[model samples]
Target: MSKIEKLLKKLCNPAYKQNVRKEELESILNHFFEGQWTFGEISGSHNYRIYHPYFKNFPEKFGPEGFLTIPVSGGKFIKHFYIKILCRFINEIKEIEK
Candidate 1:
């Protein structure tokens, strides 16, 4: 498994679920997708829209169809579950390549 796979595996693990640093998740995402963060329609929410054409059909086309719920801890931390949707897509892409 690749490093991303490993990390995603860890992130997606139910038993290991924990709050993640928002910036850390974004850094990992920046490595795989082209996107930027914007405030979401939901109050205190944010969305990371993927612009990379190759990723348009990601995660069985669930691609970029969600928003990140508000971060916790003064807005520096986010629940991994909220962003699990994002990682699922990124992982699906990685899995398909293999």
Candidate 2:
């Protein structure tokens, strides 16, 4: 697999997730999707969300409301939760790109 894919796979695991920072994952989403997606806060820095065109391709179980929660108050460790969410998101982006 490619380096990005490998990294995302590692990040998918709970053990390696805590090492990720919000800025790093946010950068990946921003850079990977570029103009095709939108990023914004639902309520300033206290809450956030990401929207992408490829979300339409997601499976029914993933939900059609089409939003991912970004936690902002649980310290750095909480970012680990986000890693799992975004890793799935990035994986979807990868498949869509292919």
Candidate 3:
């Protein structure tokens, strides 16, 4: 009935899955860094580190290369972070449905 609910319903549709793929993720990151973006202003604005502990220790283990590594600390944290954000977003969508 509300605008948020309507938007969320659209996002929940299976057709939008393709937009959430890895390539789309990479494109978003690239666009963000290229534009010198910051946090706390996006649609899914949450402290990802709070939900994922590995992100907290990333800088210590990999230094500059930590974020670039895959399936380790950085990669795992990113994967988990994205999932959490997506879920949270979906929940918001559900709330709008109500």
Return the clash pairs for model 2, or none.
none
Candidate 2 C-alpha lDDT tens digits along 1-98: 76656666777876774656556565565666555434344434544555676665663733585655566544443466767777777777778678
What is model 3's C-alpha RMSD? 11.7
| lDDT-superior candidate, 1 or 3 | 1
Strongest candidate by lDDT: 2
lDDT of 3 by residue, 1-98 (tens): 75544544454455444233344333433432234323334464432212122323456643533232222133223344443444454365347558
Q: lDDT order of candidates, best first? A: 2, 1, 3
Error of 1 at 48 (Å): 3.2
lDDT of each: 0.60, 0.60, 0.38
Residue-level lDDT of model 1, residues 1-98, one tens digit each, is: 87765776788776767888867676666667535444344575555444444454544553465333334454677676766766766666678768
Output the TM-score of candidate 3. 0.26
The per-prediction CA RMSD against the true structure, in angstroms, equals: 4.9, 3.8, 11.7
* Candidate 1 residue pairs in clash (backbone atoms < 3 Å): none
